[model samples]
Target chain A: MSGRKLIALWLFVVSVVVALMGFWFMATRASMDYWVMAGSLILISITCYLSGVHHYLTTKNRHGRYIILYGSVVLMVAGLSIYIPDVLDLRPWEIYTRIPSDFFFSFFMLIIGILSSYVSFRPFHNFTKEGAQSGAYYIIHLSIIFTLFPLFLIMFNIITRGMGGITWEFLTEDIVSMGEKGGVYPAILGTLAMISLTAIIVLPLGVGTAIYLAEYARKGLAVRVIRTAVNILQGTPSIVHGLFGYAFFVLILFNGQKCLLAGALTLAILTLPIVTRSAEEALNAVPGELRDASLALGATKWQTIKKVVIPPSMPGILTGTVLGIGRAAGETAPIMFTAVYFSGTGTPSGLLRPIMALPYHLLSLYRLVGYRDVEPQAWATALLLLIIVLGINLSAIIVREKYRQRF
Target chain B: MINKVLELLKEEKACQRISLPPGIKAKTSGFSLWYGSTKALKDINIEIKENKVTAIIGPSGCGKSTLLRCFNRMNDTIVSVRTEGNIWLDGYDIYDDVTDCVDIRRKVGMVFQKPNPFPFSIANNIYYGCQVNDMDVEKDEVVERCLKQAALWEEVKDRLSENALSLSGGQQQRLCIARALAIEPEVILMDEPCSALDPIATAKIEDLIHELKKDYTVVIVTHNMQQAARVSDYTAYMYLGELIEFGKTKQIFEKPREENTEKYITGRFG
Candidate 1:
């Protein structure tokens, strides 16, 4: 009916012809399988061109013909996939696991997105809302792929490289060969002990500071100074904290002994600001009307904070604490400078004694980079560290949910 | 509508016929309140009779709420607020050095304009006042008596463990009332208690207020002049941090006490 309509019809016919030719080439001329992938690129254009013709023919009516053609194309792809149609060399999973398929997967997605976008941008007769939205759809599709790539690649690499070192024996036995050929039992126990003490040291102190800042402290000079000080503490690097722990706790407080208490206290100081700030935000969120209601019922300031304000803010407090613990778990610098040793003696026996920790164990293995056997052990150690942090976070959420007020 | 009107009229007659004790339940003499340099309540004097409802009606920010807060010393919680006056609650000057605000607050319960229920179970919210104060009453009896008094017992009896926020807005207000009642306070102060409610819920709270006046001295601050006339035996009209008029509810509504009071009630300048 129109020049645009004629061109759209011609493009649709050309895409179908290309796809048919490519399919024939794949089945008969098996050496030229690259044509099959080019066919999928053409197939994406079919959804685009059909959608335009659909709108043109229907105007405001349902595009029955367009939907029917679109369904057929999707079904055709599904049917072909069963026959192991190697679009972009996406062969059967049984065969492609060893192949470097990342680039091909990304490339296929890009080609499909570009073709779909071209189709979606076509108008029925003139510019419309759907035509205007097609550009946005293409960008969103690409952005999603880009965002997922790094996460997918990292997780894939780690799991494949790390799982080999895991065994029942590896988890339960102590270091026997200068950190190489044994379980991380003592390190695991040390991490647990240090973090347990860290939690104990931080909760009362952090929550108390949060309460004072959020609920009790007036917005005065004192509060402003304290807030600035907290920001400064958070901005300081981990290595600096580790150095300070060495200077103050190891030398001055514990008389030059590297102990679990010193390391745990160092971590406590590092996380206190995060705990206080997030907990403050949570406390501030409890509605002022609720506070007034409590006060009217004769609950004093401290009483209201204890009962009404603190209970609801516990989830936020625990979340911040969990995040801090996650950072603490992965940090080797603080523990290395203050507490951890390359080897251990009976789980350190007490907080006063030096002990091995997971992160430090990993660092020790890294020093033995000449030994090829230690590389897998390093990867497994990292994976275990991730699991340990994730486990702590999961349990914190469970505990937080148990106490969360359904406000 | 007609039945409700007739019922309200009947209740009004009953409220009028029942003789109020002439004894003063609470009084503020030469009371003035200031938030920093800005005065909130000018030198004001008012008498609250025992077992009677006294309504304070005014435009927004007319110091009506400020005066209501004075009865229970609820204003003491605010920072940099200065008060120069003597407020006596049940024969005790509550602002004197020997007086404790906590003790004062425990004896004088308050219901806020918006329903403010703690995000706890219904039973817990109702009994929180008693438990926190460590009152000697049995928990079950306190729950039953207070909820029944607030006219919310039967509706919530089966679901006492459900979260209080799950209740309807009016139910939450009634729950707040029950919460106050649980403490068995001698005086109950309500600050625009029905402003956030719909007409039907407003009617419910008004009815509960009428029932509440028999045992507790009730002081309510409302923007609705009609609400004051419907529920209170006495009305105090305030404007711009000053007491414009204080008289019997009928005399204040029908007769001229002050020109400003007449203008406010007749929909002139607030």
Candidate 2:
């Protein structure tokens, strides 16, 4: 091996030795908080080893070495604090004790650990190209891993606790009884109705505004101002929008009616920016030459935009719409002030009546934990919400891919 | 065979250098062009004729393409650019108060240097022009006839429903030609049509140009003097956005013309 390769081998050996020593120190230590101490030592040993290896290897070249070192250090520290127990702590199998930490730990651990694992498995060799590992790829892998594990756990939990009560009576019966026999049919309908209404209000306005901004808006002060406004809208927090919806749509416009329309409108505002940005990008991606060619053939500007530009961008626009739907369906904070109701006697009869959404349903179920029978219902609702979000996102991505192939 | 064509062109230029016949009855007078505030073409005067192939030959920065674009008013789409030109087509001023650009484009069609076909069926590409011009007649017949006029009907007839992009470069140019012809424009302006095609495709386009004069007036800009000689009925030599010479193609190619036009045609400083 070359001197550089030999140095790399030596550093790897040193790291393994340190890790082994740290593991031994923690494993043998009788202290109650040895898990925390051992975890930190193990983290430091791994960091030192990896950084030493990288520093030696890149003595002549430095581009991404520091980033990897810093990233590893961060992950190591986070891993130690979150998961590695603070001294052989023993606890009973309470769902609350295991649930929150498990959710957060695996979420962070699987994500950072996968990346660190990949780096550990495939150290940056001289042959690999730079900037090849992108954020989108990382997010996609992390999402799959995080989404699947929780989903599997939820499914297992639901089957063990939820299957017996998932009959037609449990599903179709009303929640008026405030007990085990009450069904979720009204809640389900209210949620569906609100989501559908939100889609109706958002699609035309979102797509129209996107088209106008992308195709018609000239590059000037006003256009720049409008673009900045849209960006601001996108960055604004959901809770603020909920407050605005409650003040305006619920209180003033509908005379204190906190109905489905008010909630739908709030969700529409929340989803608009996402759709507009994606649609704008898709529109911008259509080659200028296509538009020129169409116009040169005597088609009007509107005609060119309609026939040539929009058709090609349809897949991207649809993807944006799907993403917006996903956000709207999962949004709870905005709907809380403007739409959700826990004590409705029955399903909403019209647009003016208040409704229930799945996220709000999930949130409210948290309050029913003391009741034994209602616990199963909450888990089932949680599982259903996850299913809906995942289903929408997966199908949208698939459809977008199919259309991309066509183009 | 190449030498023979060159010699014929030289001999023809020598004999008819003294007297030149005016080729165009239509002319653009006091014409000036601007892109934003920068002038691309100054006030220029030139005339073009009916049922004749006129070649505008110039070097890279000479604005030959710009002049051709003005013929179809294709430059109108550039928002910051402005023009003050009186272009007359058969005694009707195309830049006058009554002129609609859509109508002007319908009457005076254009083909770009690059072969840009829509990502659609070959039939759709051809019919796009016809439909846009509101010539809503029998679609297939129009497509067939325009294809025939472009001398591309035979090769593409079997694949009318196929995507236009699937065709060869030469076929795509011909498809663009058929597209222009589908609108039945009185004049067709081609800017370096052969620049992007291979020798065989260039020759095919030359053949198509020869056949095109039977129906429509054709204006082509070319760097190849041989192409100008073989296809055009009239030739206008230009340099630095100024028209240096304009005459019959036979006369311009053969006789003792201005020294500049001669030096250019004789493969001197282009």
Candidate 3:
């Protein structure tokens, strides 16, 4: 090998070794965090610096890019290892003195290594084609893995941990002894009731608004204002919707009682904008020629919309309905303040009575996670809820595909 | 084939004025239309005789379709469209204050360029107009009659419940004609009805138009000069929102009155 290529190769080897040591020390010797973190930072920084220098010397060599890849990876390992222990902390430095020494050292080493390595990579500002390609791949592949890993891991963990708790008795029986035993049947029933009620309230109004926007109303100031209001309502926090339901529906509308109706109404408000926007898009997709053909046949405006336009756009509207129902099924905050019944004395009956919902029940039981049986019940309830939401989303996609075929 | 027909017609009628036919079914006098600020049809004057196909032949953007739409006040659908004139139908001014827009449209059904079949069973597509217009009639009788009149009954008779969109392009356009006939309107306005069809489909539509003239006053707008000659009895030639020539199909084709008409007829820069 040429002398420059040998140097680049040597730098790459050292970087790999440094990244492995840093990852290992961060995982295994977390208690000896100061030395492990500081040692990793110092070693990886040296590897990054050596790779940069080696890359500069072998600019014309094909292996130059391989050197840049090692330098970038060494820096990535150093930063991740440093930030691992206290990733949840939004402000690490402010609580540095209050935190344990191990956390402080790791955070400190992470910050220093990130700063020094950033400077190390600055020399190759105009990167070679191969280096940028590998660099782009690292960013993208790492992002997909990191983003999806936790979601899949949580789902997998819930399935494995919760499947044992699921039984016919567990699903069909009512809660007993403060949810330490029995099943979540009442919560499941209550959740389904609330979802149906929400669909009942939102579907007609949302579709009406969509039809008016798409078919009747001209593009003007009034329409623009309504569209903006819908967008803002969509972005409004669910907690705010919960609070609104509590204040308006419970206090004024229903004479100060939290019930299934109030909770469903709140969820309807949350999903109304989603339904309206998607349904409007669906209605818009109906061909203009169809409308023309109907009107030309001496059908009135309403008749044209009813007979011709609505039938073709039904699948699209149903897709929007599925999406709205899915969102309503999983919503926690809206139901919490207005409907959830955790420790009620007697059996809750009718729409006016407070009832148990899976999301709020999950929230309540999660505090009792120290108990043995409570943990499994909580996981199983979560699994059930996930399955419901996933099923609705899958059906929405299927309906949308059918709608495309019709057009 | 149309040019040859015009040649024979010229020899038969030697310099005689083309008289107005027996009865004028629909006439537009002092008719003008404006879209927002631009005039689309200017001072249009024309007569549609009864039991005949009146073809409006013009280049694109020459207001042929606009003038045809004016007969039923279909232009009222456009918020920016303004009309100032008289459109007389059956000895009554259709643009009068008492004229119901719905009534005008009911009396005058329309067929479009593309075959739009409502994505429904063929039987339902024919029955919808009658149902929506509140016309109480025997559904099966009307369906069979209209389909036969359009020459589509034999092919679609067995599968009346099948979706109209599932038919071939030619069948769909014929079905649209049958749909127009189901309402049994006095006038039927067709805007480039055969434009989206193949030669065979176009031939079928042209033949149907000939049969329809026995009952309905058919006003058609066509870009193809040959289709105009093949289907229409009276021809109205328009250019740039102005009616250039209004005469029998023979006069318009054989011996032109205006230089502009001759140029346009001979395929000089439309």
* Sequence-dependent TM-score of model 2: 0.76
Clashes by residue pair, model 2: A32-A87, A33-A87, B12-B254, B12-B255, B13-B254, B13-B255, B14-B254, B14-B255
Docking class of 3: medium
**lDDT string, candidate 2, B1-270, tens digits:** 999999987665442112123545457888888888878777788778878899998788888988888887788766776888687776667666556677777888788888888888999998998777677679999899989888898998999999898999999999998998888888989999999999999999999999999788999999888999999988988888778888899899898379888888888897
lDDT tens digits by residue: candidate 1, A245-297: 99999999999999999999999998888888888888988898888888888
On TM-score, who's better, 1 or 2?
Answer: 1
Which regions of candidate 2 deviate over 4 angstroms? Answer: A1-173, A176-183, A343-345, A370-373, A405-407, B1-25, B223-225, B250-270
Question: Per-residue lDDT of A1-407 in model 3, one digit per residue for the tens?
Answer: 65443443444444345444444445564655445665665565565556556656657443445444654664555555555454345455565444344555544454444333333333333344654565456457746876998899888998898888888987888888767888888888888888888989999999999999999998899899999999999999999999999999998988988899999999999999999998898788888888887888889899998988887788878888889889988888988889886843234488898988888888888978786458888888888889888898998898778656363
In candidate 3, what are the lDDT values of residues B104-186, reduced to their tens digit?
Answer: 78889899888888888999989988998999899999899999999999999999999888999889989988998888899
lDDT of 2 by residue, A30-64 (tens): 22343443353355345545544665565655544
Please tell me which model should have the higher lDDT, number 1 or number 2: 1
lDDT score, candidate 3: 0.80
The TM-score of the first chain in every model comes to 0.69, 0.68, 0.73
TM-score for every candidate vs. truth? Answer: 0.78, 0.76, 0.79
Model 2, residue A399: displacement in angstroms?
Answer: 2.7
Residue B176, candidate 1: alpha-carbon lDDT: 94
Which sections of candidate 3 miss by over 4 Å? A1-151, A345-348, A371-373, A397-405, B1-22
